[model samples]
Target: MSSKMQRPVCLLIWLFLLEAQAFEIPINGNSEFAEYSDLVELAPDKLPFVQENGRHQRSLPEESGEETDTVDPVTLYSYKVQSTITSRVATTTIQSKLVNNSPLPQSVVFDVQIPKGAFISNFTMTVNGMTFTSSIKEKTVGRALYSQARAKGKTAGWVRSRTLDMENFNTEVNIPPGAKVQFELHYQEVKWRKLGSYEHKIHLQPGKLAKHLEVNVWIIEPQGMRFLHVPDTFEGHFQGVPVISKGQQKAHVSFKPTVAQQRKCPNCTETAVNGELVVMYDVNREEKAGELEVFNGYFVHFFAPENLDPIPKNILFVIDVSGSMWGIKMKQTVEAMKTILDDLRTDDQFSVVDFNHNVRTWRNDLVSATKTQIADAKRYIEKIQPSGGTNINEALLRAIFILNEASNMGLLNPDSVSLIILVSDGDPTVAAMGEMTAGLDNLSINHFFPYL
Candidate 1:
């Protein structure tokens, strides 16, 4: 091409670039941004670029039903976040990059929902001197932090920005063709009392960011509080997060509780010979009802109610020392066992079975509830460490066998009633109960206990 032709092409490209820059970066002169600057102090590092011309605004794409939910075309984009706890102060920043591809001019507006606990303290442009400070005269929904400060009430929480100004708040940028603008924000959060592990989600209202722009969440717990469990540790991606040691405050983890009884029984009227016996300690109150007692056969039950006399019950523990039950489970179990030992009366007889693939008996024979026997049981329980797969049924059968053998030897008092408490985290793997079994036939008699 001739030099003259090349010069014209170069000039055209430079003009397009200049136009894009002019629209993408704008100077804000508005009250909304001013009001945001008042309550919260602005930091220069956290400010976002303002949209000067219509070129920087994002237009909503029309979606077929197959694409996703419907959205407005001119909503542009917005960043919003709020704190839930009134006692804690929180701030959230939203950032996005807008790109213009169409030839026609476009603009976007962002809407944000402020949580009850927080308020905007500062709003400013990082690159330019566009300042928007909240006017003390303007009324807002929640009691403002500054207002609380003046009243000298517990000045913990703050208010937040409700709406993002499109044309004025520096959100509206004119995008001609193939132009883009980056919007960034930095939010500050302060809390009164350290909030426990909680969640705050931030995302562009559907029409805003690109279809693939993911919602990112970064949770920061109070100094002493720790995250006990999370559905997924990876950031938006399904990967585990690094495990960190917890502080003094314990983390709360949730797990589904096993149902103690089947609320609806298929064979309601039918009775089985091997009656069901539920003997639990530290169990939920609703489980205490002896629905299994209705079987009306030989069944013995013993329960350590929240407040009950610790007498007449002799317990033999068959604990699974498999590889699985370790760490917190083992530690908690041992602590509870110590408490149980303290509750035992001098006359109460007790024995211990520490089983993995095989059994290790604390006592060769059933031991009387003498102080010496109780101490020995405690020591044995303390020494138990998980090491193998759980054979719950095997452990129970062995425990029961030992109890029966003791009864025959005139060691266990048949009238006093005896219990074999099975503690296991895993279900039965090998050795299970046969098709038929008999014992505790008299509902007025003995008890069976199983703790999961």
Candidate 2:
């Protein structure tokens, strides 16, 4: 052979040998595990993937993603979960069935990641809930395991979520190939009033080959609350009660108990204790709100309310600048007030009373809008800082006096509507909502009015 041709052939052979040596995948019989094919050449124990483009591309110490995407070798794994919850206490039981359907002898390791808020009460597992052994351990975050590979290095642990009043529990076990295993986990946790979604993860280690992952989750929310703001879905029953799920999701089960008054008086009577009036009053709200106008052709007009004679021309904003109103509340309140101020007309009069420990009026009397006064008032509101305790009663009483005095002076017309905007997160320490009722006599109040 020519020297040049021989040299070229030698170079090609060398390149092929280096490539084959660098990347190696273990095949188990006929079924080539897709997971094994996807793995990178890192520390065998580490089980990190080789990326073609990212920072870990062809690197020895590879970055492992938070969770692996391989199905557990134990094919017939079943999860049975039952939950019991009250206003205070929550209990959950999970029974897992894992069957080793793989050929040949293999030692399997199991691991589970539980949610944070849960307090583990019982964790037990057996081949058929009869006889089996397992070890359960709790480690902080990251732990290391050894593997056979060119690069042997440590990797950071999985990143768990950071939330208050949350926790986790796990159990580890090893099973020989062709054997079946069962795991039962029981836990009790403190129930939270807030509604949201919670997620938990389960991981299985098929040592040196690939890792398997599973996700379990629980959704917690006041079921009917989501329907509150949505229109035409619910009707208000007796005493402003929300009529949830008429015939769907909620079962229709109601029985009116027989009473002496109901049996005796079967007709209309206006007396308070009369049986006839009681029945009528009990069902009046639902009947009125739930009735289909025009044979279900017309949608319910929930926004309908008795309109006051005069439209409100003067509005007094009584704001609470308590410490709790620091971040989102302060920022949102300021933005809302600016929008309210912009809506005021030339004929409309406005004033702001800010209260924390003590009441402070931004302006002594109702300031009529002129070009400059409105601008100055906007600037003044922008600089108000939120701090201290709430004094809603004092601020409300002072606002009533302001409105009364303005009306007496003929500055505020009796024919014009008066509105007092009270914005606060809580009731006062010294004076409560009942104490402030008398002061709200002449003001027309509405909340979540959907003005837009």
User: What TM-score, computed on C-alpha atoms, does each candidate reach?
Assistant: 0.32, 0.34
List ranges where model 2 is wrong by over 4 Å: 1-312, 437-439, 446-452
TM-score for candidate 1, please give it. Answer: 0.32
Quick one: how many clashes does candidate 1 have? 48
Q: Model 1: per-residue lDDT, tens digit, 1-452?
A: 01111111110000011211222333333111110111121232332333333332233333321122123232222232222111122345554444444555555333332233333344322222222222222333234434544354321222232222111122333434434434444444433211223343232232332322222222223223323334432222222222223234322121111111111133232111111111101111234642122123433232223454444665777776777777777877787777777877766777777777777778766667777777777888888878866666566666677767777777755557677776666555556644324444421222222332
Query: Which residue pairs collide in model 2, if any?
Result: 45-147, 115-167, 116-166, 116-167, 117-166, 117-167
Q: Residue by residue across 299-351, what tens digits does model 2's lDDT show?
A: 32221122324354887888877786777887787888878788777777889
In TM-score terms, candidate 2 sits at 0.34
The whole-model C-alpha lDDT of candidate 1 against the native structure comes to 0.40
